[model samples]
Target: MANRVDTLVATSPIKCAADKFYNFFKLNMNELVKIFPLAFTGVEVLEGEEGTVGCVKRWKYIIGGIPVSATVKIEVIDDAAKSITFAVLEGDVLLLYKSFKATLTVSEGSAQWTISFEKSTILTPPPELYIPLVITICTLVDAFLLVN
Candidate 1:
């Protein structure tokens, strides 16, 4: 049987401009660990350079009150569209997923997060837990940008 791919999308309204919000992730991702220590503990570039496609970054983040790390490759970056896609290469997330990809898109007044994945098994639950994390990150980033 062919594997089924599932998708989840969550959107949050933001106070910052789309380009500014997008640039924060594209150009200043490394600063996330320091800016939001409660949500992210570390962000390291394992290969390539920041904001470039094919770059690899390992992110240590908290979800469900537990710390988890994910190593992802920058698959696509569309500046005009204000979108970035990352493919999970390996990490704690792979333990429950056969494959995982995340895409973030910024619009005029909102940010959207999309997750596309295949489960390791039929019994494995979907990654709904990430919705709140995305929302929290969006809220924090928007506030930070508005202040600074």
Candidate 2:
């Protein structure tokens, strides 16, 4: 078994205020899914309370035009810091890796927010195959938020 961790820290500029973008992701995730169909096909709350710790959300998505889904349990949600962490409990990613976790942090700027996305995986094949896909998710979200 091989354990590998791939972490990425990136910042992008948005046209909206920091609070607006923060609230949209932290509070209005359902709406976000609706607006960004290219990123997420469906989002269902499977367990616990949404946005709270232990909450599980199953996200249906089409990556590379192939249907895939990931059921993740919310590990941490920090309102003050504007961050949320999700641990993959089941779904497509498990087929390739033993474990996966992703954390996204949004920090306020003058008129933009910087997103720090960190992902860790164990028993995965190659970082090249999965890392870009993870980063693309963040990029898609950023573009989606900026326009809508």
lDDT of each: 0.92, 0.63
Q: Judging by TM-score against the true structure, name the best candidate.
A: 1
CA deviation > 4 Å runs, candidate 2: 110-148
Q: Which tens-of-lDDT digit does each residue in 1-148 have in candidate 1?
A: 2599999999999998889999998989787787789989988899999999999999999888899999999999999899999999999999999999989999999999999999999899999988888888888899999988
What's the TM-score of every candidate structure?
A: 0.96, 0.71
Assess candidate 2 and give its TM-score to the true structure: 0.71
Residue 67 in candidate 1 has what lDDT? 95
Model 1 regions more than 4 Å off:
none
lDDT for model 2 comes to 0.63
**Clashes by residue pair, model 2:** none
